[model samples]
Target: MNDGWISDEEERTPQVTPVYSQTFGRGGGRGRGGYGENRRARGFNSRGNSWRDEGNSGGNTQRDGGNIGGNTWRDGGNSGGNIWRNEGNSGGNTWRDEGNSGGNTWRDGGNSGGNSWRNGDENITTLAVKKNNVGRIIGKGGSKIRDLESESGARIQIGKPSDEDYGMTVEVTLTGSEDCRQTAKRLIEELTDDSAPRSYGGNSNSGNSYNVEEPQEEKPRYIDFAEANRAYEEAQKERWAQLPPLKKNFYIEDPAVAAMLPEEVANFRKVNNNITASYALGQSPENSPIPNPVQTFEQCFSEYPEILTQIYNQSFTKPSPIQSQAWPILLKGLDLIGVAQTGTGKTLAFLLPGLIHTDLQPIPRSQRGGPNVLVLAPTRELALQIEKEVKKYNYRDIKSVCIYGGGSRRDQVNIVKQGVEIIIATPGRLNDLVQAGVIKVASVTYLILDEADRMLDMGFEPQIRKSLLDIRPDRQTVMTSATWPEGVRRLAQSYMKNPIQVYVGSLDLAAVHSVTQRIEMIHEDDKIARLFEFLHDMQPDDKVIVFVGKKARADDISSELSLNGVSCQSIHGDREQCDREQALKDLETGDVRILVATDVASRGLDIMDVTHIFNVDFPRNIEEYVHRVGRTGRAGKTGEAISLFTREDWSQAHELIVILEEANQEVPHELYDMSQRFSAWKEKKNEDRGQGRGGGRGRGGGRGGGRPRW
Candidate 1:
């Protein structure tokens, strides 16, 4: 066990109920590319009709006696059904470890509905689990699986191939009555409850192992509940305009009324988690559905004050879920995969611990490469955000700097020479410095990848392999992100060791469910006028951010809005670096309430007290949606996100739903079906609107002009 695995407590509760233990599987060596957000890679498979789902679901495998007429087993699964139970000689069966996709953490998702009473009828089922996770499911002493089988009342079976076979398989054969089959299906479905099926992507069509059809280009287009309601209202108004002033009801024509009805009306919340009093779902005398354990930031500080002071003068303002769960794991140097919504304080969840480890051990002077910690973010904005927060935490002694592209390379080089204790940087910029031999990462003991999913999506995998992963093979790593894509998962698996997984705010369809959502759909031709209407309707003091799809559009829209007498400014790559900085400053100081930009502003940047978010254009991805909304509703305040979509923007809306659902945020009933059929209908919809694709856009968002620091 690498000395990092937290050994189980010897004492066991009497009359224990077997819990289907699935791990996000983490715990890797120090300084490797295996840092950032939780994503599932290969997992173990074992006995009878079992499966693991979503981010919250974890896994393990084991085997021994009763093997398919042969030897013991390791990693994947056993030959036949029986796992390699007994500890045999054969050089301690090779542990078929998982790719660094990250470690599994225990979330206590909920209890199964009891052993499904499957009659030995023809109700066959297929339960597929990632091959690397077999050990955790089976656990030591064969007790884990036994409890699962006993409690579930379903014949659980795990299968793997002989050494000769390159691939591993776990099959659960069911022979039971209809009652048993129904029960089994219920239990299996509940496994990956919160998470959707993971579909992996390939490199230039090389082929990806995991596949669920790419979210189809949903047709028919999606509309927010408000939009749907508004349409209904409009249709009603037109009818009323023809009748007497008091006339109403005008027989419903919209199919949405029936389509939006609550399923089962009031029947036990069906699949959604209604009973959240416990840690997870389902209830049992022996096992509570949820593990509502709380970890306060104060407690974390009490344990690592020096670390806290080293990073910031004042302690963290709040202990977010990431910090609460991670302080314990990271301090112990366990590999971890943390999945949470954007801006939920995921950075500190690992940063504090990495900082603490440095303080406790105190990397003696003369040790190579500068500091013991390294944090990597996907975007320049995020890296800077982390750097700013770290700078606050550094208090008096520790030093760190944010390095990103577009900024002066010489300035970054000079900062490296200053002996920084922490380094926060973007993959591309950081890799450039490394290749230039301007910085050395060899001595770095702790590595982190914030926004890992987006980083890969942003096309930084190769950079990650070259710079982050190549830094050190054996180091403690922590990765965090708002989404857990298959690409990110594969990257994590290849890099992390046995790691712990952590997820927060998956209860609703989004991260900050508190944020009210509204969509304003205008005729494509009338979008500009409608946007003007929205601003005209806004209170002068309100803090609003208007997002566009392109940097040029941001500038053009800002010009147009300002021409219309609205106080506005835009931040895109083309603006001067100074101008970009100035624009952000202006927004922060209330000089400019309506700030326009592209996805550049859609990341970890924390411009607080934002009262509203205007999606002048649909976001490109779900992660972008989270980051954009995150700018508002921060510091424990309520906020609203207003999305403007044309019919063509439907696919983007559907992606948003998928992202929100994965995050456990609820999408009002009316919007669910529409969200799925969003593609083509929304595709041509963009034509109805246009932000501006004119001349310039900068790298930072648009390459704004500024004298090179060099």
Candidate 2:
């Protein structure tokens, strides 16, 4: 017997006699190697007999062979065995009499627990553990293995490496009851991870060398999407909170202004302010009172005779409403925000003052560090146009240049180095030059941000902020926008210093009254056919600007129109800068009477005699629609704006009606029906969704059980 294996029966032989009495017969004797034989021979039936037979019968009994029931084990003179025995009855009582009944039982000598063969509950299992993990299972001084044995009631054995394994792995053996062996194996796998080792053996017969590689350590990184989104929202909120609030509007009364003016100036104010348009002043401080509007060329440039002479040379007639109020505020060296329609003279409103501010600086042009005036435009076309306006008034020969993306970088850099007083640039190229050290902002005393709202929408706020970071805070700043949106208000609050606002009309978004707005509800397939029909009725010398929603659509329409014997040109962001410029030039020079374009030409474009604005596709929003219609009715000219609306644009019907009503234009009944139908469909969809989510219950708890605004 193994010294480590202890038997419960041997340890308490005297105490377990009573318990063994019921299992064994009352007079059964216990003897060395005779316990199983005595129980099977004395108390149990003999081999090859029936289960009920105790003593063998010499003569044939009632249940004997060939009798009715005698010797049931070999009844009917059968050579084949019955149910419990095999054929010939030689394998007597296979289940009870031969194997388990007398051999291999707990009452036998195998009950000692040191038996070499396993009984029913005993089990053996093997695991292959990697060399590196062997120490993990054994622990310090084999303490872990000892604890595992005591806890699981299992015997654990470590074996030497086998020749085939090449010492890369060690074998672990576990011996115990089934449950105990399983518990110990699970514990070892948990401690050592029990992964199969990697082996690169060439050959075992030739005793070739083996290569083994340790598993690489794994370190994983994670990103929290929810936390990242929360942080981004927080950053945006903090950025918005840094700016001050916008000041309220202060009305400009005609009587108060006319009381202090001459008759000529009073008539000008009466004819223009509050009648032809509205005027309002805002955020102006009491220390510097606001200046009166300049109505004429003489009144505007009376202090500078050279400027007046240049104005006459350029055929000056009168001041536009925006220019009339904007010039006075900008000329006083105060920050100004000019809000008006797109066709209003907003460019010259700030440009002339910028030129005057640059030329009149205390430092001479040569001594000033770089350009003294900087104009930031949203598009290259607008920048070039502003530069052209600056050239028209050559006061004191003030040099200027326009630099933008897709232009010759070397040429622009050379122009900057040659010492210009005025610099017109788009935000992108201006930032690039600033980073490249080719332009300086420290000496820029006059700054103008044209089309401020468009610049914000195009995601140019970062470049604008970076460009302004180095400029002196006290510099004169002027900003212009067609609509005063919240983003534009926040930007103005951050950059301007109590700027005075001079808006020509109502601040609410409205189309120009000069443009006769018309809407026609049509099918999507009929727009092309209808377009040519509209173009056929065009009067001679009447120009048109066709606005589409996308670049590809603009090219398609232009090509179709040209093939149908109509002259046209297409312009969009994807076109080259020179090509866009040429397209505009062709339209203005009547080389092409129709200009097919996207929203890129909606704002800051000045083309004379553009008698009509046609919308091939209604704009994405009402704000863009307003800007597109304003393209034709510019410079006090009357024009017509026609839009083709389809069912796909039903989502914008409500907002389009509001704009049309504000402009006093007719709203078609079909548009109202479309809006009503879309609303009904949206409400029905939400109802069905709510019913499904609530499982027939009325209105689930959160968010009314359905999403808002499909």
Candidate 3:
């Protein structure tokens, strides 16, 4: 074994069973061919220590006048008073007489301590392992780490390093001592599908702990970003030079689309661009990711009959693509990375697999730290949404909980200790629990990174990286998002294991399905009335999510809506975590569906069945717009995205339209016209400025030029 975790049983024989016999048929009987004169009837003397021995036969009853060890075998399979009382002794020939059905068994095997650790039936240990790569140490998802931990009753941490660490993560750290670590690692070598050498690193070399910090031989040379990028490119070339080139580039046949790309981008020989992406990855693009052929929302109830019966008969007539791709992979206990738009069942993709895994194989409550399946969403709302959906699937004997920044620490801690089968949470709050020791990530096996795009977004990256490092590298990983930006691409390179990139729709193109998108050009002052018009037309049940720029505006819009008799509430940074949760709860329960909120709620809030999303404050950039409209068109349901752009707002989003164009999506003619008009207006203004400057030149040309808002 790489470490002293587990040893091979074949090499060493187990000791034979020892014998301790206390012979007596105390209460056996007082029978004597009707004469009641059988001296062997040592009955009426009931010591009442019943032991079952399988050697006795022929329904014989012997007390004395017999051997040193006597057993009375009554007829009728020893049912009734002569049946075995209790074999309370430490495992030998254990027999039980419960009602009419009890078997007398000769347990030929010794204590086989290994079998005692088997997690069967409903009791399981939820081991949250840090995900680390294989060939280095622990196999992917800490597969080897998990085995070791389970066998030893020890916890193992497989720390995945941050980008600064260059994708190099640590291996298992055994929670217990040498013996525990030994048993666990031994199991790893034997049980794993992998036959390669197990990774060995640590002070004691027990295949546990990333705690061993090896001294560096020397300081590595550093380079600037551009120079480093160039070196990286050259190094890739040199690496590829040794291997024979693939006959074809990218292994994909869409040459027409390929032809449109830059020569370097489409180069069939360039190691950097020709194709180095994972062979396991399939083409989902950004839009129209692999379609989930399983069942759609409308058909869900019928598809999983067992789930339907167990969980509340929630309607699920159709299954999303993420769900389809993710379910199969999760069932096999393999790690995966799912790339899809927000609200397209990304939560379900990971949560469903985790639920199924837990339900089919239940674990003990104490060991099942919150949940076997841990879901990491980007925001509180999304976590809550996932938690709610998990409840629908609760009939399978699995429970789910949500943890995020805007919630009670005390309550979260209490429930965490109570233990749940699954947890949907944000990185920030979950990290707090981990640091406090109230939570242990070494127990998590199945992990999902929801809204992976947002996690890579600025400010959240540190927490995401830390949380990821805290988890065992041996667990399954599922990352889903509406947009896969460059940052996400780099993240996938480091964490995902031969990932399959599937997109429901390109973030640039598919966000506006079945939704009427109108780019109305108006002045800044006219925007509010425009919103009022839309709200006026909105039906009572059509819950609206109005996005605004300033916190003041969020409140202002909500006030206007309320004044106009539109049931609504406003949420912003100033709101307490409880109020935010309550606001989300209000929206979910249909209490106050028409809500106005700022950007915090926009990123990962999963407000289900939102009929419309009004970009009252159009995103400063196209990417933001992509995320904004993403709130709707979720889970395959069609929704509308309306933007009231004043000249100022329109100027901000014109590039957003251009980005849409680059993605090969259609730009509404109105948006295109608005862009041209704005350009014309700018030119006129510039022409006026040049003329004025010419006039001023005669007097004196000014040094300063006024910058336009656009």
Candidate 4:
């Protein structure tokens, strides 16, 4: 038997002889029984009979005289012909039959005339694979190799790297039967075919055939409109379930006061105080009370006489438009939704009316487990600010406590146990106390949600609902925000009963007219230098608030400004409550001329005499921009708001332009151009999206066709 070599090529022709050779004398005559005379084996037939002769001989010998039978032997004359055979019938055997007319040797036992090539023995086939494709074939951590082995039932082993300076190829060895080897080889050929590189429009290599395929354009994926609507409806239902329930036994016993005369209403809608056209009065009375414009606090302080004395002592002479309008509706015991510019005395508008209502029917001290009013603000600073204003109204007799997160809970608990008449808190901390039973809201009659839009934006809707559930059903709710979004309207519809919506200006979400806004398009690298330039122009006595986008940015800019001899104090959400209070106090008392802050100070911050607002980083949205600029230009004072815009603010360019144009401020050419480009891009995006829905092809209508619009 000869050892055979396997080639790496996929196909090869067999070169081995199939006949078994014998070194014995040749037989002469043919037997009449079965043996044919001078017959030679071309190849093994299906019966495995093959014959070859070597030496010269004489008369022939026949096996069984006709058929090749088991263990049959024939001896020829003259040369001492001897034949030996085994009939064990094991399938795999190698025959080395040598006959010198003496004898023949038989090794493993198998059928005498049967095919002895068994497929059970292991056979190995090796393939050389490109080095680049080995990792792909192996997949992540040999997952593909395991899968291939499972599918082909072949054990595969990848060879170690060789040091030869030949082509970069790795050896992949497969060990299995013939069929298994063929299956695995076919699979590997398919894998290599897929991994082969082909030029899209160029000629192929002269030595290699390329399997070029024309790329197919992907089609746009359109969402099923009915499925999307169903999902949206389900989500809305979930949100509604979390909302506060309406009062069951509560009803408006007395109708609202008669509306003020048309001339009086017209006087309230003077320049710089025009009511927004989009304001809606839902379920409001036909004769809802419309208070006349008052120039002094005395005219607006008719319900509570003690509030008048406090007003006189504090030198409160006049009312802002929001105050004058909100006073009448709130005093009439109706729900109120007020939308006014930031820093327009909205805090006092709600606080004064709430106090007057509290004085009308005071909760007895013995039965007071909670306060009579619950004021919910978005942030700790605003909550504290509200508490301060409540104190300013000569509330020595009417006790109030301020509670928020990051402060001592024990102290708040103690204060609540002391029978306070009012509680001002942030939603999170108030909800915590309510759950712990440290504070209760069942007896609370008045609820104020300040900066309601911000609260909802901060994902406090669920918390707000949980807190509202504990309060009385007939509670008088007043929600005030700089912008009235759809969420606020939903909130009113869910909780407030016949809420009278009051808008102090055009509801178009514009910056305050008292603020002169200047937008400069500059690179981010030049922002620090431009800020220094503005600082040089600012006087030492001028109070300024610089707004940054992040807390880290606020600290960085504040430190830089302070190092340059500017008295700057920074405040952000991470700052301790005491430190934040001190920072605001420093800015208010002229101890620090510059205050650096994030959007935490954008709303409900009443720092009097803020001469300038520098937006070192733009706000995230247009409503935030309005509120950030509103931090300055308070108390009927003309102030300036300067913003530094960069390429990152391109999406906000259109909104910035609208705000500037509405305020009658000069819009920079660069900003206007960016706004126009942004508008065009948005229009094109919408058009493409529409085409996608209609199953039409466009520049960006294909699946994942282009960059996202934002």
How high is each candidate's TM-score? 0.52, 0.62, 0.53, 0.62
TM-score of 3: 0.53
lDDT of 4 by residue, 164-265 (tens): 737588778886667887888876666666545432211123344445674666998998999999998788677555434333221122222234566655
| Candidate with better TM-score, 1 vs 4 | 4
Writing each residue's lDDT as its tens digit, candidate 1 over 13-70 gives: 1211223433343533222112221222222223221222112222233322211122
Decoy 2 TM-score against native: 0.62
- Native RMSD of candidate 1 (Å): 36.5
Off by over 4 Å in 1: 1-294, 306-318, 507-511, 652-710
Question: What local distance difference test score does each model get?
Answer: 0.57, 0.71, 0.56, 0.70
Q: Which one is best on lDDT?
A: 2
Question: Order of all candidates by lDDT, from best down to worst?
Answer: 2, 4, 1, 3
Q: Number of clashes in every candidate structure?
A: 134, 4, 62, 3
Q: Please give, for residues 178-219, the per-residue lDDT of candidate 2 as tens digits.
A: 798999998878666534443222222446545445577888
The parts of candidate 3 lying over 4 Å away from their true place are: 1-305, 308-312, 360-371, 507-509, 563-566, 603-609, 650-670, 673-710
Off by over 4 Å in 4: 1-260, 270-272, 275-281, 284-296, 683-710
Clashing pairs in 4: 34-65, 89-111, 276-507
